[model samples]
Target: MFARVVVTNMGNEMFNDGLFYTEQAELHKDQQFNKWRYCRSAIICFCVAAEAELAKLIAHSLRKQPHLSPEYTEILLFLTDPNSDKPIPKKLKNIRKKYNLLRRLNGLRPQKPDQRYMELTELRNKIIHYTFSSHEDVYAGTILDSTKIARDAVRDFIADLYSIVRETPPEWVNNNSSIDIQ
Candidate 1:
């Protein structure tokens, strides 16, 4: 028998964080430095939240198969290990691979993230690594557009996951709940 993993309110938490950062960005729009920083932060936060939601869905699917419990545990451990030196991109790729495999097994078509999502990820990396020009060069409109892209990406991802989960039998879902994996 598989151990029941209770998914928590991580999805809600992620959404809330995204909302908070977006609001912060709006509040700081008058200041170039603050506006760019906050807007970039908001986009990155949304991406992070979207990735978390993906992980949750993958974990939930894995937990449905008793034989895959050990692998599922390993995935959880790897993801939560703050000391691990693996890059975020590599980790995300691994998770995506697993998610794709599970989707294939369930006869679901594979869905690649949109180009805007990739662009947002690249932008987030550039900002985090200080690869961009001075803050004064960062236009408010660009920041706003990036924020919208991130928000839309997260919304689409969540909708896809919900559709997949809905197709699964209730008993296969632990507690008939969404996985938190936070």
Candidate 2:
């Protein structure tokens, strides 16, 4: 009941009541199943929220100037602007549509994300879909697979964003790509 109240409050915040539902099969001897596992969301939300924030920062940095590599530019499109909830520059908007339409998004996105973005998307999907509860769960591909994908997605976005800021040397900016490993 304690967990239930918390989940209810969270649901109201996200405006997605379904987020609180936990299946009967998920219940254990003493613990009740919730539509969501607070621990999971608590942990995963930080990662997702971080990615969202980085996306915005990258977009804002890139938007100030123009003419970046096609691939880097693609990522900038999904990034948010600093001033508002507004999206990346109008020119960069195709990534979202392209990614959604494409069957396999490895190299780039129309307005969504690139291979790195898609990998992160898959990781987020798995976490959001409740496939992380046990070792025997069907997605048994490898926990490392999702973990590595998300880690690398963050790394790659940072690299590209860094490169744009460096290679072009945005006025008043002074920094190099902090990523050490490729």
List, residue by residue over 15-99, the lDDT tens digit for candidate 1: 5566666777777777767877777767667667666766766656656765644545566556566686644433346435644
Model 2 misplaced stretches (Cα beyond 4 Å): 1-50, 62-113, 129-141, 167-182
- Give lDDT tens digits, candidate 2, residues 70-148: 7556555444323445445444443344223221222233344556655555545556665446323323334333433
RMSD of each: 8.0, 13.3
TM agreement with the true structure for every prediction: 0.66, 0.35
TM-score of structure candidate 2: 0.35
Candidate 1 positional error at 125, Å: 2.3
C-alpha RMSD (angstroms) for model 1 = 8.0
Over 4 Å off, model 1: 1-8, 69-73, 76-99, 132-141, 167-182
